[model samples]
Target: MVLVTGGTGFLGSTLIKILVDQGTAVRAIKREHAVIPDALVSSSLVQWVDADITDYFALSAIFTDVTQVYHCAAKISYQPADHAAMLHVNIEGTKHMVNLCLEHAARLVHVSSIASLGVSKNGELITEDSKWDDGADNSKYAVSKYESEMEVWRAIMEGLDAVIVNPSVIMGVGSGSKGSGVIFNMVQKGLQIYPPGTVGIVDVEDVAQLMVMLMNKPEISGERYILNSENMSNKELLDRISKLLGKPSPTIEAKPFMLGIAWRAAKLVSLIKRERPSLTREAALAAASKLAYSNKKIVDATGYLFKPVDRTLEETSRLF
Candidate 1:
């Protein structure tokens, strides 16, 4: 049986649907108040378990008879106010899961983000071997993910069979206004400002498929693969979404000065509404930076080709 954490999330839910369809017995762990996605609601092959990853006793019990474990639960935030929660969930929670997996001796597949990977300083492509520089201007989200991956690496040293996949921005349908889907929604609403940063993007299905493939290949243990399909500027990506959605493409380029003002205004609005700011200072900086990742490692390792991100965007636009 396969145990998947964060099974109610965008990627995790999609993965459970695929596994159940393939007649794989899956034990999915979700928060008690988390609503099950419509796609997995009727699947009898999925055994739902309600428990937080931080609860070692609860999680340890669920690991019984599990052959493979997929650690997908994570906290994503760029707000400074959320850093504590991010560390608790993304770092400490992962440590608990790592310990449990070690005790059960189950093969583990950790779903990490490209945020954990280091940036290229010499204008070169970032690959699996890039060293994460802690002194760099990394976001709290990136720091949390990097620390979580450290737990996975620590487990590997202690005799855990595990592999990690660092996926770029995941794009697909069914995520609604969450995750990378918010980018599509913003474009459809006639967002006029475009960030100049270049980002690596991959389809949600491709990420899930690669995780399953890696889990089946024990020979690939103790290695992490970057799962990006293509690298494109934010303007190009938004324009493609705009065309597919029949919306006007962004006309204004967001310079650093403009983004600085925008984030401050967003912070004031968030304070008034007592809600999280739509644009944090860290997120604003990331939007204006150019970063690209390489998928050569994963492509060469598994011989699996990723679907073109532009096609994925076009297909996802139809669903909206």
Candidate 2:
């Protein structure tokens, strides 16, 4: 049996669909009260359970008869207030997964993020082998992912069969104004400021596809793969999405000082409304960082080609 965590999320649900299509029986777990995506609601091949990854007792029971595991559940946030929660979910929760997978002898496909990777010290492209700098000015989310991956590596040395994939900004449909879908929504609603950073992007389907392919290859365990497809400036990405939606591209390039003011104003507004800030200081800083990722390892390992970011944007835009 195949077990999947975060089955209700964007990438997890997409992975479940592919497994169901291949006639693979899957046992998927979601957080208590998390809504089941419509695409997964009616599938006989899928068995949905309500459980928390951080709750080891609840998660351990679901590992019964699970021969393959996909650990896609994670908490992603850049806010300082979310730091503690992110550590519990992303780090402690992964510790449970590594332990449970070891007990069950189930091969694991851990879904890590490019956020966990280190900065290229010599102005070269960041690869799977890049060293993570402990003293870098990392965000809370990056710290969580980095610590979580450490749990996986620790387990691997103890004999757990696992492979990690670090995907760049994942773009696709079904996110409904959350995740990267928010970028499309922002562009459509007349956003007029572009960040001065370049980001790597990949299609959600490609990420899901690669996860399944890796899970089936037990011989390739204990390796990490970067899943990025393209590297482009934030301005270029926004322009393409805007053109697809027939909206005018952003004209103003937001510098660091401007971002500081914007995030502070947004934070004050959020305080008044008792809601999370739409812009945070960490996010503002990240928007201005220029980084790139290399996907040569994954491409050579599986010979799998990623769909163009343009095609992914066009499809996701139509759904938006």
Cα lDDT, all candidates: 0.91, 0.93
lDDT, candidate 1, 1-320, per-residue tens: 89999999999998998888889999999999999998898888999999988887888889889989999999898888989999999998899988988998899999988999968888789998999998999999999999999999999999999999999999887778888888887887789999878899999999999999999998989999999999999999988999899999999999999999999999999999999998999999889878899888898989998999878998799877
Candidate 1 backbone collisions, by pair:
none
* Candidate 2 regions with alpha-carbon error over 4 angstroms: 271-274
Give the clashing pairs for model 2. none
lDDT of 2 by residue, 44-120 (tens): 99999999899999988999899999999999988878889999999999999999999999999999999999777
TM-score list, all predictions: 0.98, 0.97
Deviation (Å) of 157 in candidate 1: 0.7
Q: Which ten residues in a row have the lowest lDDT in candidate 2?
A: 115-124
Give the distance in Å from residue 67's predicted Cα in candidate 2 to where it truly belongs: 0.6
lDDT of 2 at 239: 96
lDDT at position 244, candidate 1: 90
